[model samples]
Structure formats: structure tokens, C-alpha cells
Target: MTVKDIATLLDAKIICCEDSLGRELHAACGADMMSDVLAFVKDQSVLLTGLCNPQVIRTAEMMDMVCIVFVRGKLPDENMIELAIERNIPLLSTKHRMFTACGLLYSNGLHGGATN
Candidate 1:
């Protein structure tokens, strides 16, 4: 699905890079730990995370993630937002908790691409 589809599915607010809403993503990873994300992320995927910090943006950029969804109604600070915008990554925020948000996207066909 596209980033816009994920935004609609999670009832998330598009925080930046609205133009990237059309980008297609085949998978998702939900994590609060950047280390796990770095170890498991797949190609052009979405990251559903609860950690609201600049490191999250940096990790997503390094992983080449399609976008980031901040769960549990958490929003990043201005610095993180600026970093995301500079990286040309779309950021979304949702009121759903991490598990629920990840489940919603998974149920809609976005799978976790990491393999054991």
C-alpha cells in the first residue's frame, strides 16, 4: 500500500513530506529500539514506533524506510520534525498504541519483512 493508505488505515496525521504519500511500501516494522530496527528493517518499509526522538528519524533514514508512524498519539519535537523533513521522509502520528497500530497495518496487508 501507499503511505496515504497507511495514514488512512491508522487515522494518522501526516506531519511532513505530504508529497511522499504516494510512495508504495511493501512492509512495516514496529519498534521502540533503534537497534532492533536497524537489524531487521526491510526495503522501503514503514516504521511504526513509539519513541519520539531524532534518532528514530536517523535510523529510518539509514534504513531507507518509506515513512514513520508515531504511535500512542506521540508526536516528535521540532528538531526531530526538522530532521525528518530534511531527510525527505514522511512522518505520521496516530493515537493508536504501538501494537494496535502495527496490527492495523498488518491486517491491511503490510507485513513485517524481517526473517529469523
Candidate 2:
């Protein structure tokens, strides 16, 4: 699915990188802990998380993620947004909680990435 599709499915608002909505995303993973996200996510282009911090953007950058969905209506601060913008990663905010957001994407055919 595309980033635009995800925003529509989750009822999310695009915080930045609106021009990149056409980018295709193959998988998604939701997490609050940066460590788990760093360890488990592989080839997952979309990250769904409630954690709002600069590290979240950094983690996405490290994982080569293309987009981030902030769950539970959470919003990232200016610093986080700056980093995401610098990294060219689209940021989206959703009112749905983590589980609900993940389920919405998964049920819509966006799967979790491969696991070891």
C-alpha cells in the first residue's frame, strides 16, 4: 500500500512530507520501545508508535524506515519533526491507539516484516 492509503485507513493526519504520499510501503510494525523496534524491524518501511521523541526519528532513520505513524493522537515535538524532515521520512498522527492502528493496517493487507 502507499503512504496515502495508510493515512486514509488510519484516519491519520500528515504532519510532513506530504509530497511523498505516493511512496509504497510493504510492511508495518508498532512499538513503543526503541530497543525492540531496533532489534525486530527489518525491511519494514512503516513504523507505528506512540513514543514521541527525537530517538524515534533516529530509530526510523537507522532502520531505513520511510514513514512513521504516531498512535493515540500523539504528536512529535519540533525537534523530532525537524529530524524526520531532514531524513525525508513522512510523519503521520492518528487518533487510534497502537493496537487498533496496527490492526487496521494489517487487516488492510500491510503485513509485519519477516521474523527470524
Candidate 3:
């Protein structure tokens, strides 16, 4: 699905990279632990997380993720937004909790990447 589709599906607020909303993302992974994301995520372009920090953006960058969905209405600070913008990753905020958000995407045909 496209980034715009995910935003629409979740009713999320797009915080940056609106220009890239047309980008297509085939997979998603939801996690609060950066370590787990770093260790296990593979080829997932969208990240769904409750963690609202700069390191989350960094972790997404390391995983080559193109978009981030902040669950439970969590919003990243300016620094985090700057980092995401610099990395060309779109940030989205959703009122849904982590589990609900993940389920929404999954039920809509967004699958998780393979785990090691």
C-alpha cells in the first residue's frame, strides 16, 4: 500500500514528507524496542511504534524503513521530526494503540516482514 493509503486507513496525521505519500510500502513491523527492530526486521518499509524518540527514527533509518506510524497518539518531538525529515522518512501519528494499529494494517493486507 502507499503511504497515503496507510494514513487514510489509520486516520493518522501526516507529520512530514507529504511529498512522498505516493511511495509504496509492502510490509510493516510494530515494535517499541529498537533492539528487537534492529535485530529482526527485514525489508519492512513501514514501522509502527509507540516509542516517540529520535532513536526510533534512527532505528528506522538503520532498517531502511520509509515511514513511521506512532501509535496511541504519540507524537515525536521537533528533533525526532527533523531526523526523520533528514532521512526522508514520513512520520504519522495515530490515536489507535499499538495492537489495534497493527491489526488494522494487517487486516487490510499489510503483512509483517520475515523474522530471523
lDDT on C-alpha atoms for all candidate structures:
0.90, 0.94, 0.94
Q: Residue 107, candidate 2: how far off, in angstroms?
A: 0.7
- Model 2, stretches more than 4 Å misplaced? none
- Candidate 1 local lDDT, 18-111, one digit each (tens): 9899999998888899998887665748888899989999999998888999999999899998999899999999999988898888898888
Which is superior by lDDT, 1 or 2? 2
Model 1 residue runs over 4 Å out of place are none
Global lDDT for candidate 3?
0.94
Where in model 3 is the C-alpha error above 4 Å?
Answer: none
Candidate 2, residues 1-116, lDDT tens digits: the string is 99999999999999999988999999888889999988877899999999999999999999999899999999998998888889999999999999999999999999997863
RMSD of every prediction: 1.2, 0.7, 0.7
Clashes in model 3: which pairs?
A: none
Q: What is the TM-score of each candidate against the true structure?
A: 0.95, 0.97, 0.97
| Pairs in clash, predicted candidate 2 | none
* Candidate 2 root-mean-square deviation in Å: 0.7
